[model samples]
Each structure stands twice: as structure tokens, then as C-alpha cells.
Target: MSDYVTYDESDHVVTLTLNAPEKRNAISTFADCDAVVEAVRRVNRDRGVRAVILTGAGTAFCAGGDLKAMRDRKGIIEGSHADLRENYRRGVQAMANALYECDAPTIAAVNGPAIGLGLDVACMCDIRIASEKARFAESFIKVGIVPGDGGAWLLPRVVGMSMACELSFTGDQIDAATAKEIRLVSRVVPHDELLPAARALAARIAANPPEMVRMTKRLLREGQHMRLSSLLEISAAYQALAHSTEDHKEAVSAMLEKREPRFTGR
Candidate 1:
């Protein structure tokens, strides 16, 4: 964790908050990207961390890249054309990959605007719960650029190809209700309830067997790019591993005893 991203954990859930409120929590530099990636890596390294919630401080979940930085060619965008390409590859793209490959289940608490890279990052999560104040846009086109952080691949998978195309092509903003209608976000709550809702969801996920949850998330990620037959084989292997965990036996015993299960993430 650093100045850009704040990390907090409790009850097997880690929350990473984008902290640059004055710039609307925009990721302005390579260091900002590193902070996010590090936070995710921290979550993955902790076996007790069963879930993650990504949100932002103040308002605006994230306003994407800083406009001033882009205009001035400072920070992440500072360099020649070739340098810019490398910057993106090592900067935002790295952050995106880290989040996408995170072992624990991730939930985005979209408290406000999630534009361009912000929207894309939210999509990287397994679940997104938005505040009524939340707004979203795949607006890279507005800046005469493309999604250098994998939005093209991530967006379509979340909202379908046609809607993704429309959003990217037009650079238009959609409110929380519209996002929910298009299946972009799973739930929308009042602004004050956003964090609570996300935390509740994370708690529910964390209450389950931790290893099984991580394996299930891995299987889901693999299924995205794998053939069904291949996925079945991998799932079978995971099922074998799952059945061997003490948590699994505890779950079975708890069920048979007709009592609430207490998972130690064993």
C-alpha cells in the first residue's frame, strides 16, 4: 500500500481504496499503478484473505487517468510515442493483469464514477456493486485513445459485444440503473449503503471455505478462455483437491449436525 492506494483488512476481507480524491482518484502515474498491483499481490499472498473489495475515497470510484497528466504529457503519459507504448505496457496493463489474476474473489464497490480505465478495472473484478451515484463509461475514445489496459476484452465479456461497442465508440456515460439493466453491475444501492453492501457480499463469500472459493474463482477465470472439455478436466482436478481439505469435512459435518458452519480457511 502507498499514497495512491490504501489497504485495509478485517474478517478475511481486504479493501483497497483509491485515495486521490482531489484528482477524483485518477491513476496519474506509474507509481499509482504499482500501488494497486501491490495491494492485489498482498491479498493473494495472504491465505486468510478470502475476498477483496476495491473502492475509492470521497466520491468517484475512479475517474480513470488524470486529464492534466494526459494533456501535459506528464507522469504516465510523459514520453515519446514509443515510450508511451512501453509506459502503458508496464504501467496500467500490469495493474490490470494483477487484478484479473488475483486469487481471492474481488468485488468492486462502485461508489461513484468509473470511467475509462476505472470502468475496465471494475470489470476485472468478479462482482460489481454500484452506488446510485455511480456512473460508468468506456470513454477512451473521448481522449482520442484506445483502452491500453485490456478494456476491449474485459468490457464485452461483462456487457456483451454490442453494448461494449456502443460505449467505447460513443464515450457516453451511463448511470447506475442503466449499468444494472445492461448487466454491467450486479447491484445498485444508495451512496451511503455502497460500502456496507459490498462488505456484506464480501463477508458472505469469505464465510465459505477459502481454498474452495479461490479454486472456484480460478476455474471461472480459466473457463473464460478454455474449451469446455479442458475446463471440465481442470474442474475435476480442483474438485479432488477441494474434497481433501479439512474445511470440506467440517462443512459436511456442520451440515449433518444441522448447525452453522465455522470456516477456518483450512
Candidate 2:
């Protein structure tokens, strides 16, 4: 964790921080996008990591990609559609899949500015907590691009379709209070409390039955596009799987004994 980013874990919670604050922690290039996907995979793979919190090291979560970097690639229209699709498709899919398929609960602790793709990264998480000082935007249109990460899909799902459209079309920035009001963010606290609160939430989730949590997360993600009858079938299958876990027996026993359950994640 030599600080292009750092992942620190304790008490079954892992915190990932974007370390390049000098550029406002902007993920300016394809490599930065790749780094994010890699980071997500690494954090999710740690067997002991039950939950995760993501934030930036200095003043901002991310200001979006660097304009100078974007300028350099403005003339690049030489590739075939298939090549472009395959190249970016893999990278974006890796990022979206990392979050969508992650077994543990993930939270974005927004320290300050979040814009464009930065906001998409926030949307990837299960929960988003922002500092009162934080500002957010969907600035893709401002830069003459569509939201390339999960924004077009995720933003509308999180907020309403109209609101997502407005944000994307207008590229308007919103303060933390407005973001919370619009349900873009779940909570807002003092800047110093952002990481602490995210950690606390993650720890609370981590303390639950890990196997059940992972299964539930998977079901919820899959159920979004599934028909009601199909979802019911999936739920039953997962319920059967859950009932076989040793942790499930412990949960039942603890309830019978009126005691807190100690889950082994088995």
C-alpha cells in the first residue's frame, strides 16, 4: 500500500483511499480507471474483509478526470467500433462488476469534491456518506461526453430517471445537503466524521453473519432485472443455501438462548 492508494483493514473493515491529492485525486487516464478496478478486486478478495469504506486522502474524493489528459486524446477517432467497444467495455465492466458483485457492503466516504466519473465511483457503492463540505456533480455533458462508467444505469436506479437526466444534462453541481435530499448520498456529517462514520457503519455490517450478507447482496443485485416469479425462485434457492450454513444454526440457537450470535462465516 505505498500510496497511489492504500487499503487498510482492521476489525473486518477495509478502507481504501485515493492518494493522489495533488491532482485533486483525479483519475485522469485509462490507467487510473484500471487501478480503481484492481483496487476493488483486491479489497473484495481479502477473506477477512467483511466490509469496505472508500475515500480520498486529501481535500477531495476526486475532481473527475484531468482536462489536460482528455485534451490529449481528443483527436483519437482512428479505431474500429468493435475495438473501442471491447477496450473500454472490459475496463468499465470490470469496474462495474467489482462493485455490483462484491460480497460485502461497500461505502463511499466523500471527503470533498466528487464529479463526473468520480460520482460514478460513488454510485457503485452500496452506501454513500458525504462530508458537509462535499460537492458532487455529473459533469460528463460539460465535457461533451456521456457518463461512461455506471452513471447512466446507476444514477437513474439510485435517484429517479428524471433527476438523473437533469443532472446529466445540466452538469450542475450539488452541495452535500442537496445531494442527501435527492438521495444521491445517504448521510452528511462533518468532514472529520466522514471516515469515522463510514468505518462505524462498515464495522456494524461486518459484525453480521457474513455468509448471509453476501448471499443477500447477490440476490438483491440479480433481482433488479428479474421477473417477480423468477426472483421468488432465486430467493428460495438462496434461502436453501443459507439454511445449510453452520452460521445459520448458530443464529437460530442464539435467538433461542436470547444471546448475541457469534458467526464464524462458515
Best-fitting candidate, measured by TM-score?
Answer: 1
lDDT of candidate 1 over 149-202, digit per residue (tens): 999999999999999999999999999999999999998999899999999999
Give me the candidate number with maximum lDDT.
Answer: 1
Candidate 2 lDDT tens digits, 1-266: 23456768899888888888888887654456566677778866776778988898789998876777666642121246776566466655566667656677789999999999789888888899999999999999998988767789999988899999999999999999999999999999998888889988988899888878877887878877889899899899989998999999999999999999999888
Per-model clash counts, in order, read 0, 0
Scored against the true structure, residue 198 in model 2 reaches a CA lDDT of 90
Clashing pairs in 1: none
lDDT agreement with native, every candidate: 0.93, 0.82
Question: Each prediction's TM-score against the native?
Answer: 0.98, 0.92
Model 1: lDDT to the true structure? 0.93
Q: RMSD in angstroms, candidate 1? A: 0.9
Candidate 2 error regions (>4 Å): 1-3, 74-87, 90-93
Instruction: Specify the poorest-scoring 10-residue window by lDDT in model 2.
Output: 70-79
